[model samples]
Target: FGKNFLITTHYASLPWLDSLLQEAQEKSAEEHLMSRGIAFLLYTFLDTLVDSYFPVLDDIDEIIDDLEDVTVNSTSNDVQVRIFRIKRSLAQMRRVISPQVEVVNALVARTGKFIPAKMNPYFADVHDHLIRAFEVLDSYRDLMGGMLDVYLTTVSNRLNAVMKQLTIIATVFMPITFITGVFGQNFGHLPQVEHDNGYLFWIVLAFMGLITALQLWYFKKRGWL
Candidate 1:
């Protein structure tokens, strides 16, 4: 078997692939990999690539769990950013895994010059691994979507609660504001303003307090509180 094989990527680095290949090269002599021929080496390389996805999927699963809890319990922008980032990661994983599954399925179905009959089962195993990984990725995509929906619902509910409180406060203060404006007018000889011994001040205060209490009671009766 050759000591070197080409691994290409557009903008991503496969450091784990490099490490696995180097390890395989070191053990090639002991495993008699040369005698088994390059086909076995190729199988090993593909198997390593397929197996690498599991650990990454596991990490993503843990992240999804954490995000699920945070999304439900918290209303922070950071949670939203993390959810979108995880969603993007899942999309990228799907893009990479989907084509790989098709390619591996083709390899298993066709025994061409490059793939001998004896190696067909080995390639088929790789195909199975790819299919499993693809399924897991799709599940993660669904979970991420659910997480996003939950986050949005939680945020919306929180906003509605705040708005409800503000509306109640404004509603309760509306009559008091009107009473204040009516009594503050610059008219001469107003009915309440002409009272002796400042009784008008106490009367207006009592009247405003009574109206506020009535409004609060109505709100509570309607379950708006």
Candidate 2:
């Protein structure tokens, strides 16, 4: 029976179980050596995997901080380009981080086979860390949303300021245009049409009317009329 079981197990690649069995066989006086060896092997494997995963989570946190800085302090077209790059980086990070969460969850929900009963609490702790990482990611997403809103509002305010300046300029020049147009007419029976002083008189009157209209408009716009 032992020979047949060994033959059947040899057909599959269970390196972890093989290592445990080999170790138990090497120790001649061990009681329940196979089970003890397997338990130790599983604990060490989980420990190594969890240790490796933590560095990856730290890298993700660093990326989030860099993205937040770029999004919040950017003031040029370069900022838009940088924001797109950061978004892509975050997407890639999410892809990796989500699977890690699943892996931790699976470890926590293990039956009696892969993980020993004593190791369940350690895996549960890892699951808690993964949950915290997901929460941090959610908060970073919210901050990015707020930064985008502020950027749009800043652009809108600048546009409104430009429009207001143009409107004020147009208002200031409107009376000058009207005065010039009225004096340009070639009517034969006009009041100032027959004297040398007529041209001078019309020019002075037009200039005076333009100045008065401009002053009134300036006063109105400045709230001092």
For each candidate, how many residue pairs have backbone atoms clashing (under 3 Å)? 0, 0
* The candidate that achieves the highest lDDT relative to the unseen native structure: 1
Please list the residue runs of candidate 2 whose C-alpha ends up more than 4 Å from where it truly belongs after superposition. Answer: 1-75, 186-189, 193-225
TM-score between candidate 2 and the true structure? 0.62
Highest TM-score model number: 1
Candidate 1 lDDT over residue span 1-225, tens digit each: 234443446567687777875775777566754456566667777788899999999999999888788898999999999988998998998898889888877777876555667988998999999988988988888888888888899999999999999999998889899999998999987885776679878888999999999989998999988
lDDT (0-100) at residue 146 of candidate 2? 68
After superposition, the stretches of candidate 1 with alpha carbons farther than 4 Å from their true spots are 1-13, 28-30
Cα lDDT, model 2, residue 50: 45
* lDDT tens readout by residue for model 2, 43-98: 44444444555565577568656755665555566666655665566567567668
Worst 10 residues of 1 by lDDT: 1-10
